[model samples]
Target: MNKHNSSHIYGIRSILEAIIAEQPINKIFLQKGLKGELFMELESAIRKNGISVSYVPIEKLNRLTRNNHQGAVAQISPVKFHVFETLIESVLASEKNPLFLLLDQVSDVRNFGAIIRTAECCGVHGIIIPKNGAAPVTDDTVKTSAGAAFTVPMAKVDHLKDALFYLQSSGIQVVAATEKAEDDIYAVDFNQPSAVIMGSEDKGISPSILNMVDYRAKLPLMGNIGSLNVSVACGVFLYEAVRQRINQI
Candidate 1:
């Protein structure tokens, strides 16, 4: 097993140690139908820590380790979380019109990383994603982001709808980018403080979160393909904001 400072643990004893150490586990993978006293103990510890776990085949666990992962492996995050209010307060203190991105179920790690890179290029003050539904910011996500992930402020909130409501109260217009929208994205002015919300490719934004958006705008798609990749679409909106912000200068 590869040594890690963040407590990468395997089957029974390691998992129990991780739980006892109070280390934050990004995720745990357990082989399905693995019956053992240790397995049950690890399962109990995992639940007590509130860590998310997935059941996979023993082969999958073997792939993660040549030695004994005991049908279990855990991935950990490198950074501590940031609070949404702290990010908002920092933006307000800067006296700049806060530009933000709220991601709704964008599970693709590369796409999420690319979006963060674009958001940084466009001068986005912060990026918000639901704590549960978003992509894992693993080593791959950070590598794909090309260090932009470190430079940008990211907040993971428990509920996206409530986060939108908070942003609205803070004077940031929440705009939803969906193909079902009635207006062109270009028609909306980005000079004002704004937050743009993008959804997963499989299903657009969830209705409850969609309803919270102040504006719904769509990009003009003339190609045979009806939609763009979420990362590319995010770049379009972010640069539009950049263009408008530049024009004002």
Candidate 2:
């Protein structure tokens, strides 16, 4: 694809190079029943890095790109993701009260974009997401974020639980936003180094993740609606942190 529409990279060699360079890739499509020395090398690389791949018919590859794909095509992410541990360490070292946002399988591109924008406004140091189920940073996501996707640092991990453990070890408290919590958002002490976890749009935070958080807090809902949209709730949660921090200053 052209630079303007460079969301995908075709051809086996090119895809392999992109992977080696650690480009943020959404998924790779490889022709089924095709094999060669270089192809074997590519497969080894993909497996070593744990990059997502799919085996498909040559016709499927052809449909993905008009170019000579050589039986490979990889969807690329617009934003370059940061290293999870490195990002946390850097933020903790620089900022006295580092704030983070953890997304638990938030699949909607628009919602993810809005959350990034809100996180940026709230001065969140970084955003963490799981590699598998989370939404890829597509052009639509970047547009919806109003370019905030480029501004805020983001990291994708094999698991959110691992990221949570790293954050807690680094002295940042993890907070989960869910209606199941008895404590409201206001009761949580956001003045400390904090990381807020927001769940997927449909199910809310998973029970597994909810149990791991340092604090479980919810928003006060006055209307008939039981809950706010994930992005809206995220905004409320983040701004509460922003509000508390501003008051401290």
Candidate 3:
């Protein structure tokens, strides 16, 4: 799913209108060294909405949309992003045991969609991803999730580490799935209010975020391949929680 060829709005004015309307913008590509009142207004709107913006050359904006982009192009997200605090507060208001999924730099759109689908199926309360680096909710992603993208609550934050910290402070256990952990996934208790952090395919979880997590657990690899696709691993973790909760009741 290349956003370079995805649905986007061009022209600074059009993009500003979208921002003002609170449309779900996945990413904004602005021309480097751009300046002017309109650009200032666009920047202000972006900051207010917390939209992801990248300062790229005009050529890059042209590549995204060759339709009179006027130095700014914004890709629209198919699914609206929930605010981290608002999402958590809503879950707290529910009084049900919370299950949140956090993706650390998971860039593949298909994997992201599949993870969200599985999260929905497993009764995850919400999904979280960094505003930058993570894949946006595009049409293909929504298709891959079979409409789960709209059903599941998803949030985008400035940093995964801060979200992790906030989740801990809110009394939600932060469990990171990584190969580096000594404890196996089976050993970790997931019946508590929990947020599962799944890392990228190639790099796994970042060391800094891993250091902040309360517990690190891994799935034992019986096969020689030594890895599982991130979505598959995520489903395994999520269902484990489901299983634990079901039995507890």
- Candidate 3 lDDT, tens digit per residue, 1-249? 112234788888888777777888899999999999989998998887777889998889777875777898888897778888999989978956898999999999999889989998999889999988898899889988989999999989988988998999999999999999999999989878999999998999999999999999999999899889999999999999988999999
TM-score of 1: 0.84
TM-score of 3: 0.91
Better of 2 and 3 by TM-score: 2
Query: Residue pairs in steric clash, candidate 1?
Result: none
- The model with the greater lDDT, 2 or 3, is 2
Kindly give the stretch of ten consecutive residues in candidate 3 with the minimal lDDT sum: 1-10
Q: Tens digit of lDDT per residue, candidate 2, span 1-249? A: 222147899888888888888888988899999899999998999988877788999999888889888888889999899999999989888899999999998999999999998888888899999888888898899999999999999998988888989888888899999999999999999989999999999998899888889999989999998989999999999999999999999
Per-residue lDDT tens digits for candidate 1, residues 30-124, read 99998989889889988765567889998887777666776778766654456888888888889578899999999988898898888888888
Every candidate's lDDT: 0.82, 0.90, 0.89
Range of the 10 consecutive residues with the lowest summed lDDT in candidate 1:
1-10
Model 1, clash count? Answer: 0
- Regions of candidate 2 where Cα sits further than 4 Å from its true position: 1-5, 32-37, 56-60
Assess every candidate by TM-score. 0.84, 0.91, 0.91
Question: lDDT (0-100) at residue 99 of candidate 2?
Answer: 92
Q: List the residue pairs that clash in candidate 3.
A: none
For residue 125, give model 1's deviation from the true position in Å. Answer: 1.7
